[model samples]
Target: MTIGSNSPTRQGQLSVLLAVCLAALILPLSFSGAAMATHTIGQELGGTAAAMNWITNSFMLTFGGFLMTAGALSDVFGRKRIFISGVVLFALASLGLSVAPSLGILNGLRAVQGLAAAAALAGGSAALAQEFEGHARTRAFSMIGTTFGVGLAFGPILSGFLIESFGWRSIFLSGTLVGSLSLLIAIPRMTESKNPDAAGFDWFGAATFTAMLSLLTFALIEGPANGWTSAYVLTLLFGAAAALIGFVALENRVRQPLLDLSLFRYARFVGVQVLPIATTYSYVVLLILLPLRFVGIEGYDEIEAGLLMLALSAPMLVVPLLAATLARRIAAGMLAGTGLLIAAAGLFYLSRIEIGADTMALVPPLLLIGIGAGMPWGLMDGLSVTLVPKEQAGMATGIFNTTKVAGEGITLAMVNAILAAFAASALQQAISGKFNGDEIGAAARHLATGDLARAAHLLPGISPETLAATYGTAFDALIYVLIAITLLAAAVVFGLLDNAKPSEEEANPVVSPGE
Candidate 1:
C-alpha cells in the first residue's frame, strides 16, 4: 500500500504521484473561478442578476450533493476506476461548456463538471490515503491540501488572464485540456484500492441523501433572491426538511449507509467537521467580497483586482506546509485555533478599508489571512479521517465534505443577505440626508451587477469627491459585517475545540486483526 516502493526506480513513481496530485489540484481550479467569471459573463450575455447567482450555486449544489455518494461509491468500487471515469466525464463536460451557445447549456455543463469533480475529489483522496500510510499519509494529506490552496488562490487570477487574453470560453477550453491530460496520466499509473470486504453499495441511501442535499442546497442558494417568505422558497425549505428527515430514517434502517449518522457522537469528529465549515465559509466570503470591494468601489480593473487577490492567495502556497511541519510538534486543534484567531485579526483589519484606501494598505492583512486560513485547511482533512475507523473512512470523509460545502453554501447566502441589508439601510440614511434613495439603490444594484459606470450615474447632486467618500462609507459597513462573521468563527474554534494531541492509532488506524 505504499507509493513508489515497488517501482524499479522510486523517483519515477514519485513523478507519477506528483502528477496525480496535480490532477487533483486542477479539478478545483476549473470551477473555483466560475463564481467571478459567471458573474462577469452572465451580465454580458444579458442575464439577470439571479443568473449570476445560479452560475455559482448550480455547480455547488451538484458538487456538494454528490460528494458523499461518490466517496461511498469509490469505497465499494475501485478508486482508480472512479477517478478515471470522473476525469473523462469532466473533460467532456469542459469541452461542451467551452462552446455552449447559451447560459442554460453552460450552467448545465458546469453542473456536470461539478458532478465529475466530486468523483475525482472523492477518488483522489481515497487513492492518496491508500497509497501512503502513517507519517507518509500525513505528508500526502498536507500535499493535497497545499495543492487545493494553490489552485483556489490562483484560480481567479488565471481566469482573469484567460478571459482577457482569449475570452471567457477559453477558461473552459483550458479545463478540457487539463482534465484530458489528468485522465491519460491517471489511467496508466494509478493503482486500484477497494475494500474487498466492503458492504454492498447503498443505492437507496445514496439516492435519498443526494435528493436531501440537493433540496437543501437549492433552498439555501435561492431563498435570499426569492425572498425567504415566498411560496417557492417555503416549498423548497419544506421539501428539503422532509427529504432530510427521510434520509435520516433510511440511514438508521439501512445495513450499509452512505453516511454514518453516529459519527457525530465523538466530540473530536464534531470539531473536525464544524471547524472546516466555519473556515471555508470565511474563506469564500472573503473571496467574493474582496474583489467587489477592490474593483467595484476602489476603481481597480479586473487585472488589478486579480493581482490584489494574489496577496490573499500567495501565503496559502507556503503556510500549509509550515502548518503540517508544526503539527508534528503541536496539536492539530491548537494549530487550527491559532489560525482562526489570526484570520479574525486579519478580517478586523480589512474592515477598516476606505473607498479610496491605498491598495498597498491591504497587503499585510491579506497575507495574515492567507497564512492563517491555510493552516487549518491543510490539517483538518487528516485530522477528520483519523477520528474514525478505517472501514468508515469513506463515510467520514463524505460527512466532512458535506459539512464544509453546506457551510460554504449557507455562508454565501447569509453574507449576501447581510450586505444587502446593510447597503439598503445605508442607502436609506444617505437619501434622507440629500442623496436620492432610488438613485443610490439603483447604483447599488448596478454595482452588484458588475456595471460600475451605470452605478456612477445613479448618484445625483454630489461632487465626484463626495460621491467616492459616500460609497466608501457603504463599503465599510459591509466589511464590518464580514468582520463580525470571522470573529464569530474564531470564537467557535477556540471555545469548542479540545486541544488534545492525536495518538498514533488515531492518526493511522490499523486494520482489524481478524480481517
Candidate 2:
C-alpha cells in the first residue's frame, strides 16, 4: 500500500494529497464559527469575560498538545490510516457539538474536536511531504498554504452568516458535511506511507509531552484571569515547568521520541518554528480585536462586521499563491523576514484607528496586514521541514504546527486581557466624571447606536464629550500596544534568523525508527 517515488500511481497519490489538504481546511472553518459563537453566547449567558476566553483557549490547548503525538503516530503507523480515522472522529465530534445541551458539554466537545483536528493536520502534512519531492513538493506546500489563507478569510464570514440565519448550532452541523466529503475522498484515494522499520510507539513520551504541553498552556491562558500570583496559578505554572523538564529528559532517552530535539541544531528549522508564533500572535490579536470593535462599538450587526473584517483576510487569500512562486526564486528566510516586516507595518497603521472610524478607514491597513500575514503563512511549513532530514519530516512538521497553535492560544488570551483592561478603565472614567448625570447618560446611549438624534435628550454636556474622547483614546492606546508587539516580532525575525538556503545534509538526516 506504500507509494514509491517513481510509481505509476503517483497521480492518484497527488489526488489524495489534495483531499488531505482540503480536509485540513475544515477544522479552521468549524473552529472560527465555534470561537465566535462561544464569545457571543457567553455574553448572553451572563458568563464573565474569562469564560469567553476559555471557549477558544480550551480548543487550542488540546490542539497544540496532541500535535507532536499525532505526527509521531503518523510516522510509526500510516498517514492515510490515521487521516481517515481522524476525519471520522472529527465528524462525530461535530455532531456531538451540534446537539450539545449546555456550555459545559459544548466545551468538552470542542476539546475533542481539537484532538481530532490535530490528528488530521499532522497526518495531512506528513502525507504531502511523503507524496512529492523538489519543485512539485513546493507547489503542493504552496497550495496547502493558500487553502489555509482562504479558510481564515472565509471562516468567520461564513460562520457569521450561519449564526445569523439559523443560530450557532448550524455552524457545527455544516461541519458534518465537510467532514463527510473529506472522508469520502480519503477512503479510496489516500495510500498508506508507513516506515516498516520504524520503532514501536513511544507511549510514555507521548503521555509526558501531552501532560507538559497541556499544563503549560493552561497556566498561560488562565493565569492573568485568576491573578498571575494566585496560589492556583502558581501551582499550575510550577507543575508545567517540572513536566516540561521531565518530557525533555524522556525524549532524550526514548527510542522513538515524540520530538527530535536535535532538529533545533538547524538554523532554518529554528527560525521557521519561532517565526509563526510571533507572527500569529500579532495576527490573532487583530482577528479578536477588530470584530469586537466593529460590531460592539461601531453599532454594526454581526454579518456586517464580519464582511468588513474581510479586508484583513482578502490579501491573505491572494498573497500565498504569489509567495509560492516567489519562494521558488528567492531565499525562503528572506521571504519570511520580509513578510514579518510588512505585517508589522500593517499593524502600525491599524494603530491609528479612532472611535468613530469608518470601514473605509480600516481597508488600507487591513490590506497591508493581509499581505504581510499571507507571505509567511505560505512558507513556514516548507521552511521548517525542508531544513530537517527526510526521515524526521513528520517531527519537524509537528513542531511547526505546535508552535503556531501555541502562539494563537497564548496571544488570544493575552490580547483579550489587554483590551478588557483598557475598555473597563475608559468606562470607569466616563462614569466618574463631574457632569449633568442625565445628559452624560443620554450621550452614552447615542454613541452606542452610532448616531446623533436631534432630540434634546440626545444632547450631552462638556463632560460627556470628554468621556467620548476618553473611550477613543483608550482604544488607541491598545492599538499602540499591539503595534509594539508586532514590531518586536519583526525584530525577532531579523535578529534571530540567517539567510541560507536549505541544505541536503539537513534535509535527509539519519533515521532511528520514528526519526
Candidate 3:
C-alpha cells in the first residue's frame, strides 16, 4: 500500500508513524540512562568491574547480532506485526530488569532487551518508510533523527534525576511505561506492510554473522582481564576471525543473504556507514569514561555528573537540526568530515586539561564535542537509506544501528581495559624507587578505583602531594589515548567520504517493482 493513499483507515497513518518514531526515541533513553547509572547498579548488586561492563555489552552484542535477521523477518512477515511484538518483548524485559535478583540475571535480561530493541527499531524504520514518501518521508526521518539526538542529549540528566529520587530501577520502569503506550497506539492505528517478493530467510548467514559479533566482543572484553595470550582468549579471537570469514562466504553464495555485500560498492554508502563507528569510538567513549572520572576522581555525585554531561550533550539538540538544514545546501560527505575534524579538535583540547581541572574547565571542550557529534548525527542515517533502494530499507536500517551499538560496546570495553592497564603502569612508575612491593600492591588496588585517600593510606610514608600526582598522571594518560584515537578517526573520515553531491535519483528511494 502506498503512503497517504485515500483509504478509509489511512487517515490515522500520521499518528501511527509518529508513534513509531517516538518509540525509537525510547531506546537511547534507556541505554544512555543506564550508562549514567552503571556505577550505582554495580554497587547495589555487588558486581565487580568486569561484571558491570557486561551489563551494557551483553545488551549491545545481542542487539547488533540479531538486527539483520529481525529486519529480514519484518520484510517477510509484516512491519506492524513485528513492530508490536518488539514493543511487547522490550517492555517485558524492562519490567523484568526492574526486579532482577542478581547481576547474572540482570545481564541476561539486558540481552533480551537488546534483542527486542533490534526487532522494534528495524520494523519501526521500515514502517515509517512505507508510510511516507519523498520529501514527507525525509521530514519524518528528520523528526526521528531529532528525537535520537535529543534523547541522547537529555538521557543522562533524566536518568540522574530518576535515579536520585527513585533509584536506578526507575530507569527501566520508565522504559516499560513508554513501551506499553507505544504498543497500545501501534496496534490499532498502524497498517501492516511487507515486501511482497521478499526472499527466504538465510539462516546460515545470520548464524555465522551473529557468531562473528559475539565472539569478537567476547575476545575484546575478556582478553585484557584474562591475559591476552591465555588459551580461552586466543581461542575466542581466532574463532571470531573464522566466523567472520564464514559469514562473508555464506553471504556471497546465499540466494537471499542477510547483508547485501554488493552495497559496499557505493563508496558514499561505505563512508556513511563508517561515521557511526567512528563517532562511537570517539564521542561515546567520552560518554562512558567522563562520568567515571568525574565521580571517582573529581568527587561528584551521579546528579552532578549528569549535569556536567549535559554540557557535552546539549549542543546535540540544536546542531543536528542545523546540520540537517545545511545538507540541502552542502554536500553531505564534506559536512560529515568537517564535523569529525571539529570533534578531533575537541578531543585534543580535552587532552590538554590538567588532571585537577574542575567541571567548569570542561564546558568548552564538551560543547565542541557535542556540536561535532550533532553534525554527523544529522546526516548519516538519512543518507544511509537514501543511497539504497527502498526495498532494502529494513536491512539498511538494521546494519546502520548495529554498527552504532556494536561499535559503542566494543570501544567502551577497550577503553575500560586501557584505563586499568594505564592506571597500574602509572602507579608503578610514580613509586618506582620509593615504595615496597606490599605497599605498592595496596596502592595499585586503590588507584584502580581512583581512590587517592585509600591509596595514600597504604603509602603512609609518602606525602599527600605525591599520591595526588600519581593519580593525576594516570588520568592524563587516558585523555592522551582518547586524543590519539579521535585524531586518527578524523583523518580516516576525511580521506574516505566523497565530497560530490548525490543526484536526485540517488537521493530518493527507488519505487521497487512490487510497490
In terms of lDDT, the best-performing candidate is: 3
Q: Rate the local accuracy (lDDT) of all candidates.
A: 0.69, 0.69, 0.76
Instruction: Pick out the ten consecutive residues of candidate 3 with the lowest summed lDDT.
Output: 506-515
Q: Taking the tens digit of each residue's C-alpha lDDT, what string does model 2 give over 1-515?
A: 23335678776876776687778778678656765465456544434345555667778778888887888888898887777777888889989988877677777888898888888888888888877776566667667777777777888798889888988788888877888888877788777887565688888888887887777677666664565688997888788788888888988998877777886665545666767776675576667656655654555666877787788877778887777667656765677678877887887787777666777998888888888877777777666666655666677778888888766766666665555455445544655665444444434333322222211234434343454455465557766776676677666566544444333323453323221
lDDT of 3: 0.76
Candidate 3 lDDT over residue span 404-451, tens digit each? 777777776777667666665776787687776546755654454445
- Candidate 1, run of 10 with poorest lDDT: 506-515
lDDT of 1 by residue, 321-351 (tens): 8887887778777788888778877777776
Best by TM-score: 3
Better of 1 and 3 by lDDT: 3
The predicted structure with the larger TM-score, 1 or 2, is 1
Clashing pairs for predicted structure model 1, backbone only: none
Q: What's the true lDDT of residue 218 in model 2?
A: 75
Candidate order by lDDT, decreasing, is 3, 1, 2
Give me candidate 3's TM-score against the actual structure.
Answer: 0.90
